[model samples]
Target: MQSAEGTTAEHTAAKGRPTPKRREAENRRRGPVAPPPRTQREAIKRMRGNKQSKEERRKAAAERRERMMAGDDRYLMPRDRGPVRAHVRDIVDSRRHLMGLFMPLVLIVFATTLVQNIVVQQYATLATLVLLLTMLFEGFVLGRVVNRRVRAKYPDAKDRPLSIGWYAFTRAMQIRKLRVPRPRVTPRDAAKVG
Candidate 1:
């Protein structure tokens, strides 16, 4: 048998010139072959007589209705029902806002403590350490508050920090201090049919 590229297996019996495989391959590579076109009226009638099963028809009709309502009829595109990323962004934004609110007050307290110190040079390293710790603490406090509020609102939210360690401890503190209720939808509500 000869390959499409004209290489032949020696075991194959050659025809009068090239193998049958080579002739078939040459015909396939030469051009595209199209089936004959059907008459539009005949095609329409045939399609009308060919009915889909009731369930399939119902599903198709429902999809068509949805597309019509959405008003983008170019294609049957999938709908995105989740707002997870937006919720995460909201948490990040709230964290940043609260950080902005409390950072200045923390800095002022640190500055005052450093200013009245008996030995300025002696406390420089301690002051630096305090400042770093304060910034980190502020970030933690604000992050916890934001995350707690978000988690309470969206209990089933994926990628949320669920552990009660470190940041989770701070979240508990924020929940306690601010009296923020961790309101969540029940599992039954989540299991409800759409």
Candidate 2:
């Protein structure tokens, strides 16, 4: 206990610096290195000083949008964040589903009904009903298949079947060219289907 040569009598490395307090360590982690503000006005000025320039923010937003369109996880919406949803999207994109024509078929039916001929309108209505039934049937089958495959791949996935199943169904119904996070695989490149 009587050491005098700048050495501690204790059995320790003795770097001679006391540990930093938790609050100080947290502040350092938060990236603010200035001394504590002596007044409220200084604190307000510091807050405003931390903000980025408008150009910097715009560039950052554009970059984030690009990443989102490319299906980068960090920028994806909450509903699209997980690998399970990505797998579901890929599966839907890789296949040719009849429901993918639903939008075009609807337009065709609408156009046909604009004609004055009763027979043409009747036929258009009939065809529309038939297409709806077919789309529903195809969507049901696609949902089941995709859900099974997703379960096979991500067995421990926390996603519920209805959530991802509907996601697959809705994705399958969209026009391939218009799907967001554009198809990673073409119809011929479905290597991940297993």
TM-score of each: 0.28, 0.69
Query: lDDT per prediction?
Result: 0.48, 0.87
Candidate 2 per-residue lDDT over residues 14-84, each given as its tens digit: 88889999998998889966689999999888777666566688899999988988999999889888889
**Residue 154: error of model 2 in Å?**
1.2
Predicted structure 2, TM vs. truth: 0.69
Worst 10 residues of 1 by lDDT: 176-185
Candidate 1 on 1-194: residue-level lDDT in tens? 88889998678565767545977888888877644438888766656655556668889888776654343324323321234333333343232233333445555655766665667634655655676676568667655655676567667866546431233333323422231222122224423211
Runs of candidate 2 exceeding 4 Å displacement: 1-58
Cα error, residue 104 of model 2, in Å, equals 1.7
Residue 193, candidate 1: C-alpha displacement in angstroms: 29
State the number of backbone clashes in model 2.
0
Candidate 1: pairs in clash: none
